[model samples]
Target chain A: MTEVTEPAIETVTIDVVLSALADPVRLTFVRALDAAGDWTCGSDVLRETGVTIGKSTLSHHIKVLRDAGLIRTRVDGIRRLVTLRYDEVEQRFPGLLAMLREHGPARARGISSPYTSG
Target chain B: MTEVTEPAIETVTIDVVLSALADPVRLTFVRALDAAGDWTCGSDVLRETGVTIGKSTLSHHIKVLRDAGLIRTRVDGIRRLVTLRYDEVEQRFPGLLAMLREHGPARARGISSPYTSG
Candidate 1:
């Protein structure tokens, strides 16, 4: 059996991560990942959101997030599976995710309807 | 006795906050505020960091962070005293601070040397 190659871990600054999250599209992507505790693909993410966006733009957003270390991807056959690196971000930023969760109007009250109402 | 005017509350999205934090200067500002635990003026902050910057640029950076609701200011005599509104951010973005703290490389280990070492 061939050995599976582990993806190289790249160091990203908090500023970069925050910058990646600055875009509305990226924020929505993060929220969706948080809501759905499973790996997702770019096409599926965009389709689920129903947001009209060009392929290049979507690709750009995903790339930004990936570079910031907020999301991790793995090759699954012919598909790329994406998941949030909550542990890594938590280890790097400390209190940032808690602040997001606290400030998240919908999730704060145990309600997950922020997207629909926000 | 006259009543001091309370600063108007402004609504800011997480994306805005993250955008403001994307800047290296702004991130330094936030980290300084976290370290100081008190209201600080723009001049003092700039001086403390010893980072050479023009007045206009510094003003612009401050405005960006203020617009994002990460910091609040009150006019104290002729000086503006600025403080981080951690509580407000916490209320709005639950789990964000915790995440930041957790991920903070230095702070996570119960150390306050992130600035010097990072």
Candidate 2:
């Protein structure tokens, strides 16, 4: 059994959380995790988000989020399940995740640019 | 008169805003600006936040925030006045600055760590 590590919710900083979520793919992952609970690595989550990236890249992004204390990863046999620390993060940063949940999908869709036509 | 550049509010992306605010000093700046409204660079805002950073470093952080579209800067005589684009940011990603305004001070005070004593 591989032991997964994560910081306590109170230990997380807004700075670290912001840094973790600064990437497009990771933001998409968090939005997905918020909408649909526990997600397995290399699952349909990526496909659902419409993001094209290598498996190693996705794993790296997950590692960053885990290190930032915004997520929990557990090993269920050979598969690793990822869960967003939504409530914990909300306790620490209040409305951060709610804002992400509301606006993140439009960002992930690359429609955040003002120059782009609707 | 030096020209100050910033992205239009609609051009701002949540990712850039998060990256801009990931730093402690920058976060403090935004929080202060949010609380006090228009602030002049090189003013007592730093003293208020209790952050000890140099002038050049502070300028760099301000530039990051400005480029990220989280702030608007205008040259007011010799002083560069900085203002949080509060409404614009709120329009782009609702609840983001409100979250920062609500919880940012605690994070700035270095009390975000669970290991720290209250």
Candidate 3:
């Protein structure tokens, strides 16, 4: 099995992060992960996010998010787990996640996440 | 003179907005407009924003922003005045501008605009 590694926090650029979130499907996926709290099983992302993209496409989106350092993935036996790298991202871009969560249409859909003033 | 109109606010999508903000040069330009507060002259944008892109490319970026409903432009004699569609964007995405301007790398570089907590 190939090793699963996330990009270093310092390597994550704002442009890359924004680009990753620029897709509606990816944005929705991030919101679902955000709503998941600690971590979410990889399979649940599509169901929770309601993204219509197929499994292959979803895997691609997940790769983009992970490459941008927006998320972390852990390999647990056959099942993989994913979680938002909220603290690292917030530290790098400051209030970005909160801003999107608070105001971007992400929060208004499935998850009524508490307001986070950026 | 062709009538210059920005895309309607309702038509603006977050994906487009994020994609518009994804480019480093364009993000810098938006930051300059944010610092300018109101109606920055087009010529001043390149100078003020320090975007090194050629004129044609800058125009393209401006068009993308306009199409995304992130900005507005007005024709004044030979000069075109461009301004951030702050209120409309705020109503649409809320805290997005503030996120970039407030904590984004935009403010840390040159203009130290008053901190806005998104």
Candidate 4:
């Protein structure tokens, strides 16, 4: 399969960021990047999710996140290092990350419970 | 125009929430709701954005946000009260809002600066 060229940097928008994050797989990837704090290859990042994903799909998801400006990637030798662009995204959408922190499981008083629909 | 029925509650997905927030107008609305901490009519909410928006368009956007579980709305008499579902969204997407808060302009040392491309 041919790899699609990444989107132009100029076209990055909030929609792209939200769309990229809408996926559970992609969200997991981002959380891992947040935890790793450095460039991580796709395989290493997906380990925590316990899901087996195809390489192409993973690449696509990364591209989406990159396009949304949620993550930044650099080519180091033959490996691409991915890091969360927390600062950039937070700048664009204020009050978003703080809200997430308040609800983070790590800070929760008990086992992180799923949200209830009332 | 005919109103589309709201999406099934079960079908409400993170993608929908992200997609709703991807828009500038919608984000502004959520911010206002966060500030207000109560239900607000669409017309009142759009005033802060300084954009002239149609009712149908606003309805559509609200539906998107509601479906994403980022917001909860209740009918108060004939008016719909819209409030940010900060807890629910934060629960599902941990560390997101906290990150946003760190970047929020209100907390910024200076005028909230738009994100710069690097």
Docking class of 1: acceptable
Question: For each candidate, what TM-score against the reference?
Answer: 0.70, 0.74, 0.72, 0.52
- Measured by C-alpha RMSD in angstroms, how accurate is candidate 3? 6.5
Per prediction, the TM-score for chain B is 0.73, 0.83, 0.86, 0.68
Writing each residue's lDDT as its tens digit, candidate 4 over A80-114 gives: 77776667656566654444343332222442323
- Interface Cα RMSD of candidate 3: 3.4
lDDT of 3 by residue, A5-110 (tens): 9988877767688888888888877876776666777567676545566778878888999998999988877778889998888777776676666545623554
Off by over 4 Å in 1: A1-12, A90-118, B1-10, B94-118
Which candidate leads in lDDT?
Answer: 3
DockQ of 1: 0.41
Model 1 error, position A61 (Å): 2.1
lDDT of candidate 2 at residue B69, scale 0 to 100: 95
lDDT of 3 by residue, B4-118 (tens): 8988898776768888998887888887788778887755677654557677887898899899899998887787889999999988776678767654572366554332211
Give lDDT per model, in order. Answer: 0.67, 0.75, 0.76, 0.61
Give the number of the best model, judged by TM-score. 2
Better of 2 and 3 by DockQ: 2
Off by over 4 Å in 4: A1-20, A23-25, A31-39, A43-76, A83-118, B1-16, B86-102, B105-118
The per-model DockQ list reads: 0.41, 0.43, 0.34, 0.20
Q: What share of the true interface contacts does candidate 3 keep?
A: 0.49
lDDT of 3: 0.76
Name the 10 consecutive residues with the lowest summed lDDT in model 1 chain B.
B1-10
